[model samples]
Target: MRVDKYLKNSRLIKRRTMAKKACEQGRVIINEKIAKPGDEVKPGDIIEIKLGTGSTKVEVLSIKDNVAKNQSEELYKHLKGF
Candidate 1:
């Protein structure tokens, strides 16, 4: 799945546009490198997101076709390091 879409479906960013903008602005990283919105995402990939002075990091646990709000957390596993 696309990285931006994965973020929205995973409930990490809440909206696809926000996630896309984040990626375009160089705030989102895949494998420690800046990633575009169209970047492909798969299991085990590490993603880092910069939010203001704070940041979030997560490991792609499983890529889903679609996840409801209740099961969104299953999309990715949170990582301790940002």
Candidate 2:
């Protein structure tokens, strides 16, 4: 899935446009490198989202064709390594 779509579908960013903007501004990273909104996502990849206070890091655990809000978090697991 595309990084922006994954973030939106997973409910991590609230909206696809927000995710896209984040990526455009270089606030999103994959494996410690800046990632574009179109970046493909896969299992075990690390994703970091920059925010005002701190950034959020998650490990791609699984990818769903589509997910519900209650199940969105199952898409990625939080990482303490960040």
TM-score per candidate, in order?
A: 0.93, 0.93
Candidate 1 weakest ten by summed lDDT: 73-82
Model 2 stretches with alpha carbons more than 4 Å out: none
Model 2: residue 6 alpha-carbon error in angstroms: 0.4
lDDT of 2 by residue, 1-82 (tens): 8999999988889999999999999999999989999999999999999967688999999998779889998999998534
TM-score of 2: 0.93
lDDT of 2 at 10: 88
Which candidate achieves the best lDDT against the true structure? 1
Candidate RMSDs in order: 1.4, 1.8
